[model samples]
Target: QVLCGDDRIDAAVTQVISNLSSPFRSGSLLVNKIEAFEGKELKNVADLSAVVVIKSLADTTVRTVRSSRGQSGAEPVAKLVVPALAPTPNYDAALKQLIKVCQEVHVPLISLPGFGDLAQIADEVRFTFLRQLKLNSTRLHTFLMNLVVEEGLEGLVEEVSNQLNRPVSIESAQFSLMASKNMGGTPASQQRSLVDDVHKSVRKQLKVADSNDGKDWIIPTLKVGKRLVAPIMLGENIVGYISSMVRPNDDMEAIAELLRPAALAAMIEFHQNRQTGPMFAATQKSLLRDLLLGGTLAASDQERMEQHYGFDMADGILVFAASALNAQGQPLALDGLPDSFGVMTEIEGTATVVVPYLANSGKTWQQVAEALQKQLKELVKQKPGGADAQIQIGAGRMSETTFDLAESYREARQALIVGSMMHTNKEFTIGYGELGVKRLLYLMIDHPELERFCEEIIEPLESYDEEWESELVPSLRVYLAEGANLNSAARALFIHRHTLRYRLEQIAEILKVDIDSQEVLLNLQIAFQIRDMMSGSTGKRG
Candidate 1:
C-alpha cells in the first residue's frame, strides 16, 4: 500500500521494488549494484521493471527484450538486453558489461539467467512486476482523476500548480492578466506586473529544455532566472500564455511537462467561450449600427440596449469615430476596445465608438469633451502599439436623447474628415461645434462641380509653383481670410505689406483676375477649399 503526501514517483517506486521477496534475489551471491545502497534509501528510480535476459530464449542474434507488461502503456515495465552466448572464461566480463548497460538505460532491477534457478522463480517475479505496475498506475490515475472536475480557468491553474508544487499564471494574447495562482501569496518584493520591464529579465534566463523538440510547444526552463513562460497555443495561433515561478532547486523539465495538460485545458475553455461570446456581441453590434444610423429608438430597443450594453441613454450619449493607422498610414486591425459605456462598430472600414453620456449637473459640453478626451488618452495608452498607431478621435455634440443619435453620428463622421484635413497631426479629437466654414464646404466637397470649379480657378496659381510657389498662394489665402485687410494679412503671413502686395500681384498675374474682385475672391476661397478637400492633408495655412 502506498501512502501519498506529495511524495515523488521515482522514490516510491524504488522503495516498493526493494521490498520484493528474497526468491527474486540471489541470496549469498550478492550483486554489487543491488547491495551498493544496502542501508540508505534509493533517491531515484529510472526504470521500474524486472528485466530478464536469456541466451537463445528468442530467435534473434541480439535483442532488447520487451515483455507483455508495457503493451497498453507508454513505458515498459521491464527491459532486458540479451547478448550473444560467449565462452565461460569471458562470461563474467560479459555479465558485468550487461549490468553496466542496464544501469545506463535506467532499468532498476535485472534478472540474470545464471542467478539461482531463474526459471523456477520466473512466475513469482512476473507477478510482482504486474503488482508494482498496477500500484503505480492507480496512484497516478487517482490524483489526475481528481483534477478532471476543475470548473474553470482558475481551478485548472490551481490544480496544475498543486500538482507541480509551483506558482502559475495565465495571460491573454495581449499580455493582460487572466488568472493566476500563488500570486497573492507572494512576498511583496517578488510581485510585479507581468507586462512591465521586469518580465524581460525573467524571459532572458530561459534555455531550451528539450533539444528533441516538436512544433506544438517551445518548452523552456529557467537556466538562471526565477520564472518560466510558455505559449498556450490553438493550432498555429498563440491564443494565450502560461507562466510559472521557479525556485533554485526545482526540476525545470518536470515543471514544463506538468503544465502541458493545463495549457490544453485552458485552450479548450477559451475556444468554447469564444464560440459562445460572439453570438451575443453580434446581436449587440447589429442593434448599435441601427441606433447610430437611424435617429429612432423604441421603448423595447432602449430596454434591450440597457440590458445588453448596460448604457443609460436618459442622461445623454456622445458619438465618436476612432480609426487606427500604421506608421506607413495603412489601416491596422484594432481590437480590445473599452466596451463598458460604448459599443464599437465599423462604418466604411472605420470604427465608431458610441459612448453613453451622463451629465455632471452643470458641466458645459466643452468640459465634458475635455473629460472624454482624457479618458480617450488613457484608452490609447492601454493599446499594444499605442505610440506607433496614428489614432484619430472625432466626436459629435452630446445628444440629449437617443432620437438625436443619428445626427450626432453624422457630425462625428464629418469632424473626423474635416478635422483631419485641418490639422497636420494624425492624432486628434475634435467636435462638430469647432468646425468653421469648412463644415459647410465639407457637406458640398463631394459634388463634382465644386471640385471642377475650384480646380479651374486655382489650377494656374497651383501649377506655377517654381515662380512664386510658397509666397503667393499663402498670401492669397491669408488675404482672403482676413477680409482683404492688408495689415492683418501681412501680419498673419509674417511678411511686410509691400512683400505681400508683391506676392498678391504675382498671384493675380498668374490667375489673370483682379485680386480685389468679389467674384475672384469667392473663386479663390472655393479653390482653397477644393485643395484642402482633394489633398485631405492636415496642417492648413493661416
Candidate 2:
C-alpha cells in the first residue's frame, strides 16, 4: 500500500519492471516475443534454452493454462522478477501455481529485493537454480531409495492414499490388479470399467507413438487419463503402473511427483515379487500337498500352518476331493481361491480341501466345503467358458487328527472316481458314508476278483444291450436296486410295469436264476456295485 501510494515511486518501479521483463519491441515497439523451453516457461528470462534444461513430467492434465507440468499461459521475461502478490483470486491462484510448477521443473523462480538491477538478479538466479537442482536431486535420490520396506506394495499404496487423501492402485502392464486402497467398494464390473478406460487410452498412445517412444526414456505425457497415472517401468518393458483411483482435482502435477516415489517403491516390490513369486507359490503348494496327503510337516511349519489357518492339529479335519472343469472342459485351478472362500488346493486337476472337523463358528466342515464350491461357481462364471463348467465333489469321514488325513484323502478320491463312473448320465456329489453297499465295493476296487465277479453277473446283460441297442443291464440294476419292486422299477426305467415284468423274465431266463428269490436279488445289487467300482477306479486306486 505504501509503495503504491507514492505516485513517483510507483511510476518509476512500473517502468523498471516493464523494461526488465521485456527485451524486444518494449519501449519503442510492440512486445512480440515468446520463450518456451521444451514445454516449460522460463521465469524472468527470455530464453533459458542454453541456461538450464527442464525435465518433462508426463503432462497428464489438460495441456492448457491449468497444466502444472508445462508452461501453458505464462510468458518468458528478460530479467529476474516475481509476481508481486495481489488480493485478486485469479492472480493469487496463478502465481502460487506457477511458482510450484517452476520449482518442480527446475525452472528458475527468481525474486527481486531492494537495490538490485535486472542483470544482477538474473545472474544470481542462474547460480541459485543450479545449486537448488543439485540439492533437489540428492533429496529425491534419498527419498526413493528407501521408499518402501516391509509394508509391501499394498501397504505402500495404502500409505500413499492416506497422504494424498485419494485412492491409489497399482497394476501390471496387462492391468492385472496388484494392490489398491481407498477405491470404493464397488463391484468388479465397476473396477474393470475403470481399468478398461485407463488402459484403452494408454493403448491408443502406445499404438500411435513412433518406434522410439520410450527408447530414450521419454514416456508421452498423457492427455486423457481420468486419473493421474504414471507408468512403472523396468528397462524398456513396463512391468506395471501406479495410478490414482479418482478423477483429477487440481493436484495433478503433485500427484505425478508423489507417484514417482511410489513407482520406484512398486518397482522394488514387483521386481522382488517376480523373482520370488513362483518359488514362493511352489513352497506353499508343497506344504499344502503335505498337509493333504499326510506328509510330515516340520514342527515349525506345522505350528505356523495351524496358526495361519486357525485350526488345531488335535481337532482333526474333514477331507473333500472335487473335480472341476471350465466350460471348455479344461481343469480349473482352485488353489488360489479367495480367502473369503475357504482355502483349497488344486492337486493334479482335483480340488483337495481340508477344514477343521468342527469350526467353533458353528459351521460344519461339509457346510464349509459347500460354501467353497458355491463361491468357486461364482468365481468361474466371471471367466469365459465358465457357465458349462462341471464341478463334482466327494467327501470322506472326519479324521481323528492330522495323522488320519491320508485315509480321508483316499476315501474322498475313490468316492469321486466311483460316483462319476456310476452317475455317468448326470453330475453327482458322493460321500463315503453315503456309498451304502458301494463302500465295500470301493475297498476292492482294484481287486481282479471284484472285476471278474462283476463281469460274470452283468456281462451277458451288457452284451445283450449292446447288440440290441437296449438298456437291459441298466434296467436290471435299477430293478434290483428298487428291492425287486416292479412298480418302482418300471417308474425308474420310464416304462410300464408289464414291460418291466417281461424284462425281468428275460433276465431270469438269460441268467438261469429264479426271478422271485431274495438271495439272487442281493447278489445282483452287489454285482452292480462291483461294476461301478471296477469301471470308475483309475490309476492309483487305494
For 207-226, candidate 1 gives per-residue lDDT tens digits of 23223353223433323247
Q: Give lDDT tens digits, candidate 2, residues 472-516.
A: 677787787688889998998899999998888898887888978
Residue pairs clashing, model 1: 423-539, 424-539
Candidate 1 structure, TM-score to reference: 0.43
Deviation from native of the Cα of residue 275 in model 1, angstroms:
20
Backbone collision tally, model 1: 2
Worst 10 residues of 1 by lDDT: 23-32
lDDT of 2 at 177: 72
Looking at model 1, residue 300 earns an lDDT score of 69
Residue 508 accuracy (lDDT) in model 1? 83
TM-score of each: 0.43, 0.43
